[model samples]
Target: MASPQYRLVYWPGIPGRGEHIRLVFEETSTPYTDTATTSDGLDRVLAYVQGNVPDDNINPPPLAPPILQHLADPNNDTNVTTISQTSNILLYLATHLPPGSIAPDPKTDPNALFYLNSLALTALDGLSNEPHDCHHPIASGLYYEDQKPESLRKADNYVRVRLPKFLGYFERVLGSGASGGGKWLYGGKFSFADLVLFQCLDGVKFMFPKAVSKYEREGTYAKVFALYQAVSERPKITEYLKSSRRQKYSDGIYRYYEELDIEP
Candidate 1:
């Protein structure tokens, strides 16, 4: 019997939260169809968010894009399992994908998966989500222009305080010896958490080039910066970075606005 195919439903243009899942797929060389690049990708993505895709499996429906669906047959929904939320999708994929693709085996280290999930969550909360709010400080419903003044103030504290605090935390994690005393975020093996942190740092560096560059130059978070470099240089990741599949940063989770850009 043939194996099920993984399908990723997300927005077409920007990487957004979906990029974290995409990196896992790419790094692991997992075969999956990304709706964003398909002919009717966005429409399919909206089907889930709009409650148009009827599946008895999903209750309450999903509120946004970046949903993952496992299909025994792409053309049939009999054995379909759909799930939303980036971290949830990553955790699911980590366990379902081939061994050593992106996570350690839970059978051996029972706490490994949970620990990695915690790490990924921390990176998302402190780096991705907070950085996004720096541009839309007042409200997600309001446009960046509508909240520019408040955004500027938010960006100031983010760059000077929050950014470093998060970076420092990760650096401490790397040096803590709890991560199996290696570059990997957990168990001394490459896991989804490492990818999460790498993507978060990549987005932050793009959005706050000045602040990130200063920190790197000063070697304040050397381990954190080093992890970024290591992940960037990975064979598959290097190819992905150069490929068209890797989307550029824009008005997504991490946005660059000169008015809101402040040095730490």
Candidate 2:
């Protein structure tokens, strides 16, 4: 209804590393524009990511997409502030925005945000980062076809070893008292960590449906899947999932490869 103060710079198509960032705004109904709605939108996003946007006070520019931009105090400076990296952006939003915006207030209980961020990073590390390497085992720039043999080997280890490690860790966390009996990841409260885990597993499901079905069918990692279900069913997130904003996974990190979807 109004001009959103927050802007999300991500690739136009695949979710890539941007979906978790989008989930924060969607779950909270926070106003955020995913890319600019203008002819210069692509150009501007590239400028920030490709080092065309010269640094003033901040020296390093964003080297990739999934960048977040918010206007500084209009009274002091009209320039938009840009920050990159998934976890960094999430932490920034949680702290810089009003308390209870994404996670607990850093001042009252620093441990809450600390735990939230820690869990989020763990999810991204095992589920997000490692999964990407499964397909592009040789190199990110190389096509999957060029590295099929390597992808198969990497994916076999991923689904057999890495996937269960991450899933089991979250499952135990959900069952622990700190998780408040499976509804939430920490203290029975919503956090961006929950969103991160959801996106990661959701991608896993897409990337390796057969492997996921084996676990689901065997009832392993039930708590993590339960948490995934709970997050997806949230009112705003539910709407967002069914909406056009939710892009399908394809050329991004999580990709479905028939041969690579090994049973764990």
Candidate 3:
């Protein structure tokens, strides 16, 4: 029997962190099932993270959404290999799929995978996580209105300090020899890392337009914005963006509160 297709399990309706994984599939034109869009999707996602499934040795239960499950072991029909975490999923796709589909094989270039992952992790932390914190500085369980005042302070500092730090770092990376003339994050090739950065930066731009535009106008981080544009224009990505599968940034990780758009 053939192996089951790659199944991406994540919350529906918003891009959220799952988008980073989605881009990889789209970029490589790999066939996969996005469970979130199917009928009764959330119920399937809930099963893994909510402990609705029986636990065993093939794959441990996951803690949250953005799960990847593949039934690659044909010999054992019952055990599915489950994996979680944004970077972990990306790494698995990069390495497990044909090498260079998402990134160069580590055997050929020892530093490529690690370098890409490190950059992706940094973008996730400073751009994605930090922006989410701006709206929920007090607690994730609380509503944004419940923590508006503290959120204002956090958003202010993020726009002025954290935002610039991340943008500047990516800008420098674009200029570094590793970027190969302002195209990718490493070694002049489009890796899963580029896809990860593209999603994170897209979220950053959506959340802090004024500040992102300010840095763009300065031309200091020109390459950072350029890389974003390049990724946005990729044939597959462009199509995905126009498709309904590309969820809009709403209450998810990247939210645009007018007050939080303060220019740095």
Over the stretch 140-257, how does candidate 1's per-residue lDDT look in tens digits? 9899889888888898999999999999999889988787775877878888999999999999988998899999999979888888998999999999999999888877898888
TM-score for each predicted model, relative to the true structure: 0.95, 0.93, 0.94
The TM-score of candidate 3 is 0.94
Q: List the residue pairs that clash in candidate 2.
A: none
Which ranges in model 1 have alpha carbons more than 4 Å from their true place?
Answer: 1-4, 57-60
Looking at candidate 2, the ten consecutive residues that score lowest on lDDT are 71-80
Measured on C-alpha atoms, candidate 2 has an lDDT of 0.85
Q: Candidates' lDDT values, in order? A: 0.87, 0.85, 0.87
Question: Model 1's lDDT to the true fold?
Answer: 0.87
Off by over 4 Å in 3: 1-4, 73-77
CA RMSD (A), model 2: 2.1
* Local accuracy of candidate 3 as per-residue lDDT tens digits, 71-175: 676456466778999998888888888898889988999888888889999999998999999999999999999999999999999989998899899989988
- For candidate 1, which ten residues in a row score worst on lDDT? 54-63
- Predicted candidate 2 versus true structure: per-residue lDDT over 1-264, tens digit per residue: 346778889877688788988999888788777863445667877787678877777535788988988866433435678889999899988887678766878777779888898899999999999999998988988999999999999999988888888999998999899888787898887889999999999999999898888888778888888888988999899999998889888888888888988887
